[model samples]
Target: MKSRHDMIERYIGLMSGTSLDGVDAVLLEMDAQGKPQVVEDSFLPFPAGVREQVLQLQAIGHNELDLAARLANTLARIYADVVAQLLGKAALPAAAIRAIGCHGQTIRHAPHAAYTLQIGNHALLAELTGIDVIGDFRSRDVAAGGHGAPLVPAFHQDVFASDTENRVILNIGGISNLTRLHRSLPVIGFDCGPGNMLLDAWCQRHTGKPYDANGDWAASGRLHQSLLQQMMADDYFQLAPPKSTGRDLFDLNWLEQQLAAWPALDAADVQHTLLQLTAHSIAGEVRRHCPQTQSMHVCGGGAHNAALMQALQQQLPDIRICSTAELGLPVHQVEAAAFAWLAWRFCHRLPANLPEVTGAAGLRVLGALYPA
Candidate 1:
């Protein structure tokens, strides 16, 4: 007879990044050694209206409290639907899953002010899915006096670290973050300025597409060196580690402000320059911090941008750069799966946040659990 204790415990990780694109969910299984194996992954893009509302809520506006609460409920339902789809695809019952690790949509992340908000009602999700839900994973870290952003480096260390080589796990979502991994060193990580956030926003405005596919539009345009230099001089890029950023600093308004100087520049040229800014900012951090890095494994939406990849390779010719898919996990699955690993850690009462990466007072277990 199969005993409950001897059965495999499954966890679902849900993430909706700053790109405001949509939800990404993944079902994961952990081995006896605490390594994660992705069982299934799924993505559901936000409706245009929903996406717009979320973007609006990023900045202060009238009746935002009411709007944010309503949207949180809507996101919970959306998350529940994704959970249902994952269970159906895997042929598993809700009871078979231990808990879900959900990194809800980040409408605001102000760690310096001592708060970070991610809204997807975990209690409602628990009731709707009939599975335990663990969420609000960042607030506690912020309470511990940490940035509470870029929480995936600990997961990167667990899954991608190699004893024989120094590696950097670069996740370029709406915002880019890199984890510096070495066999004998503490993990170092921080946001690498903007990633697909500015590019996607600019592309959507000019091309009407959510993102620039394969950098086709960017390749069609010319790179403006002056604009790139001006953007690269932003204070955020000059800040030391223990830092993080989102739409709060690198949104459409910020981009427009930068473009205001060059009133006659081509839109595609602006986009091309933005792409270079992302590549340059990321490369600058790697060269400054992880100079000994042998290879950089990239994941997230930016991994698909050929022009950006070429620019990164050009900037750091000494190191090898490739998609994280080369390392066991698929490019899109890394962030979602990291949340699942976080849930597994929470279930075991283990500390998941890296003190070195997030600058917390010390190691701490993240997330709040809502039982089914």
Candidate 2:
């Protein structure tokens, strides 16, 4: 085995998941298939009007390809600035980082139709930061007939696998997904549905905060049974595994429609229902797909929300609900670390996608390599 110092290479990970709330950047060091030691991480909120513009383009009421392209450039600029910030904080030069692993801002995530787009151009990120960049981490899997999502399971397996034990790794980003890893089989994963995506939007609409703190707003209100039932009826929930979805399927309009059908319900009732929808859908999917999932280890921003965690526990009492913390990783930083691992895989020319999970026809190397 390599010495500890041999694992001390620097790498930066940049991510803007379906929530689109902000950018998450992290610096980490770890050997291949080893525990990542986080050196530093920071969240840079999108500019005041920036997130809204992306949402407008994502929402039902817009026509602006030009706007998206410009926003892409702006996002890359922000990424570059953050890299500078990271380097400054770490007391390192640009040359120190082995690579910049970027998931980018997902503008359109439609894998079934055979194409997906994540802005924040790697070309620009590479040029501005003077660092090698790896991105576009999903398309090749889609080309192979996979869901092109829940891409972190491979990394999770690498970092979490043991000699003779099983684990379920749940990532609750803008959308929620779970990775069930075990010895003697191909690792598998799938999207469970909205995580913080709907909850964050609901809170912003009602209280002006970016998100519901621990789902406190949801706790203040009660679920609107009508809306809950209607939302639970969504066909997406019933679709088989090997499925993937994004803001395109579950967004403000989607949530609003479920609310509109039950016009008499208060906004709090709507918020309460949304939270239940997230928790229940996730628990239900895990039960359906990974019944052997003994313990569910959570990650992403939503894992810290107490109310949502409580709701999930109520739905799946048979399974233990825990954070990635219990598994030796921080909840908020797992996805960020995922891209870092993806970059490592790319640098090694290793296949980063699982065909069964992404619906890919075969093992494929995901992500494009951009030179410094």
Tens-digit lDDT track for model 1 on 1-372? 866446677999999998788899999988666867898999888875989989889999999989999999999999999999889999989988999999999998898799989998889999999999999899889999999978999999889999898999999899999999977778888998999999998898888899999998998889899999999999999988989999889998999899898998999899889989999999999988886889999999999999999999999998999989999999999999999999999999999999888889999989899999
**How far off is residue 74 in model 1, in Å?**
0.6
Residue 282, candidate 2: C-alpha displacement in angstroms: 0.7
Tell me the whole-model lDDT of each prediction, alpha carbons only.
0.91, 0.83
**Predicted candidate 2 versus true structure: per-residue lDDT over 220-252, tens digit per residue:** 898777777888899999988788888999988
Alpha carbon lDDT at 230, candidate 1: 93
Checking candidate 1 for backbone clashes, the offending pairs are none
Candidate 2 to truth, TM: 0.93
Best-fitting candidate, measured by lDDT? 1
Off by over 4 Å in 2: 1-8, 30-36, 59-63, 183-186
Model 1 weakest 10-residue run by lDDT: 1-10
